[model samples]
Target: RKMSALAGRDNDYIFRQLLEYTSFTYTYILADPESKEAILIDPVIEMVNRDIKIIEDMGLNLKYAINTHVHADHVTGTGEIKKKIPSCKSMISKYSNAKADVQLSEGDKIKFGKFELEVRSTPGHTDGCLTYVWHQKNMAFTGDAILIRGCGRTDFQQGNSGRLYDSVHNQIFSLPPNFTLYPAHDYTGQTSTTVEEEKKLNPRLTKTKEEFIKIMKELNLPYPKQIDRAVPANMVCGMFELQDAKK
Candidate 1:
């Protein structure tokens, strides 16, 4: 089923959080209210129709459909979204080796109207993982690099526990303590978390680098069931051909 929520809004931006229940993924929509130009982040293929409706109803000029990385748990909707909004380009990290209209790298900035998202290469969960920071908004869209209280399993897709340890500490934890972090997926029904909260309370991330690596190595997480199909489709920007497969 498709579910969405108006998480918050302010004079600076329009924010909404949409969820694909099956994967517990959260797709975010952020727009410059004044210009009505918007960007969709971490879009899921199954929810494209619902997401498009929201944009049209709000009269938003869809600017970009961006994937923080080449997702392995669910197919991305960037390709489908671009088809619906021809002017909307699809984007992914240049390091992802994925097909997209635009390839982003560290220090690259994505501008939609007056709002911008600064790209930070936070690789660990995957070699191409990215975290998009809206410095002005004091918020970041953290892919699978880190989660609400836990972190992504560094067991596949170029998984590296040591590298992940450094990425979070240097890239994410270094942000302002009050910066709100919106992760790609949340299973506990949590909406968002702040840098301060994660810094002090994140059981997996709060430990020292050595400790973090050790903990990650022992997680023994079950293999993701969708990876075989999800990765291929995501690589092509969600243009998957397996209609018989389920997300």
Candidate 2:
């Protein structure tokens, strides 16, 4: 699906989207219009063809495929995308224990043409989660750290409610109020929200840190169906072994 193209701070770059239906995941395409240098964020393995087609059609030079975290619901398309586009490098958090060409850390800057994204380590939903902020554009890609009305569950994958609370309040909420916040997943069909809106209106975030911890402790949410298959595959950068055809 085609989402709106958001111009950068100086209108020199564009942000495109490719939403995956099954996982409710949002893959972003950030590109510099002048140089046509582009990077993709959180790509889904199943949608590699569509993503490649889009990149090819736009005549953009794919530079990198970056993942916000090692997702439990869907396998990443980073490895496959790199195979298709040899020039594209795959990136992930240094703490994720996942294999990637580039392992990023906090304060690492990813540059594409004239635009740059600052990586902020925001571990909560997972210990490796990283939020990418486009400072000049006043925008952030919050990978499961702070959602629209809620946040990621602190029930698995090294999740810690207390850490999550601090990450949001200190790392994210501290940003300029008007900064646009784009999450990795939004099941309700809501596209985007602002940092101010999330700080003031997010039900989960409005509570005190202690209260938030209690709430997360009692969530008892069911495990994701794909966790068993996805986690292992994601660890190796989404390389899964298939059964023999003649079995």
Candidate 3:
């Protein structure tokens, strides 16, 4: 089931659909209009044009193009977008083990006009995974660390069920009840949930740590179709060498 909601729209954080594959991947355009500043998160290479148009049409400056993690599904357009917007800086967690213009860590706040995004190191989906909290609007962007009504699968690279359990309960769930949660992927029919809602209703979250691990282990999930290719490319600093793609 596919889940979606028009959450960021009302907040003025304009979102444009770059790509939504059968695997259900998505690239987002999250912008702060007050500053005319913008960011592309988990962007798909295929949707590069649509992304560029939004920024060009709005006459906005793309200050950053960030990936929550080295994605293992679709090719990322982080490097591609940088060329179009020369002044735009590309950022990724320092743990990505890939080169980036701005390697960010926890406690680092990215300021945009009246907004400040506080970085929280939430490792579980990936060791270097980080989540952003925009204090100005009480919003949080959970890349694959946590999902809307569900949590990200921890069977992939650096994916540890124990780490995921701790990351959510200790770091994410601890946030105030009213903080809005915006996730990168929406696999279910729900879109954009509150942290409190996730802590209470997320199937994977509403259980004991021990039990959660049990469930994950039992699944014995299969590898993502592109994991072999995506992981290597992603760790290479999100570069799209022409020869390394699936035509």
Candidate 4:
């Protein structure tokens, strides 16, 4: 199965890793030895066991499980993982429309181990969306807010082109050109992309704001069949409500 293969890759990628997981949607785990602290970002719930094993195997303690927003595609495994590692905190952006142990805003910094992640509110794909920037790696994780070759669609709940444009051009694109982008979704089948590459080659990016809006309206795609199920599950951090396992 696709999920199985992804799990294997995820584990293999973490040997000397700086907090990375690659389930259906990649879950990032960054740990620092001096602080004995670790943080999980935008993780898929199905890989909870793999993540936990990795955490314990390394003797690092988890401190945070952060979601960029209420997801429409994948379920967050944060809550389930939290139960496993009681000390870990759950975080999300205030705009996420979900309950959070910690609600972050743009420029908010979370310190753990040797890294500090600065939250950037990038709300084009979803109103409550967020992006995390690691100054050490010069890498940014844009959760569903932006993708390689494409960006998050603005056709669903609280979505709008005007806002998407503002979020992308003013907030996300403003970052330095060389920064590598690790998007929540990997539709491109590539490992990752850089800010400069997206700015130049993303078809949507090449158009003027007005043109981009028109194109999006004209190319309205079908609703995701799994959104109804995914959203509520994601809202609560991927816990099944007793009957979820049956589906």
Which stretches of model 1 miss by more than 4 angstroms? 1-9, 241-247
Q: For candidate 3, lDDT tens digit of each residue in 45-155? A: 667788888677766678888877777876667777876777888788897776678898888877654556888888888887888887667778888888876777788
- Error (Å) of candidate 4 at residue 213 is 1.1
Clashes of each: 0, 0, 2, 5
Residue 107, candidate 3: C-alpha displacement in angstroms: 0.9
Q: For residues 126-240, could you state the per-residue lDDT of candidate 4 as single tens digits?
A: 8888889886767888877668887777899777877787787877788899988887777546657888998999898668999988877877698877689778887666656
Return the number of clashes found in candidate 1.
Answer: 0
Model 2: weakest 10-residue lDDT segment is: 1-10
- Which portions of model 3 miss their true places by more than 4 Å? 1-19, 242-247
TM-score: the better of candidates 2 and 4: 2
As for TM-score, the candidate ahead, 1 or 4, is: 1
User: What's the lDDT for all of these models?
Assistant: 0.88, 0.88, 0.74, 0.75
What is the C-alpha RMSD, rounded to one decimal, of candidate 1? 4.7
Residue 41 alpha-carbon offset, candidate 2, angstroms: 0.5
Q: Is candidate 2 or candidate 3 better by TM-score?
A: 2
lDDT of 1 by residue, 1-247 (tens): 1112232335557888899999999999988766789999999999999999998887788999999888889989987887788999999999899888999999999998888999999999888899999998899999998899988889988889888888899999999999999999999999899999999999999998889999998888899989998998888898654333545
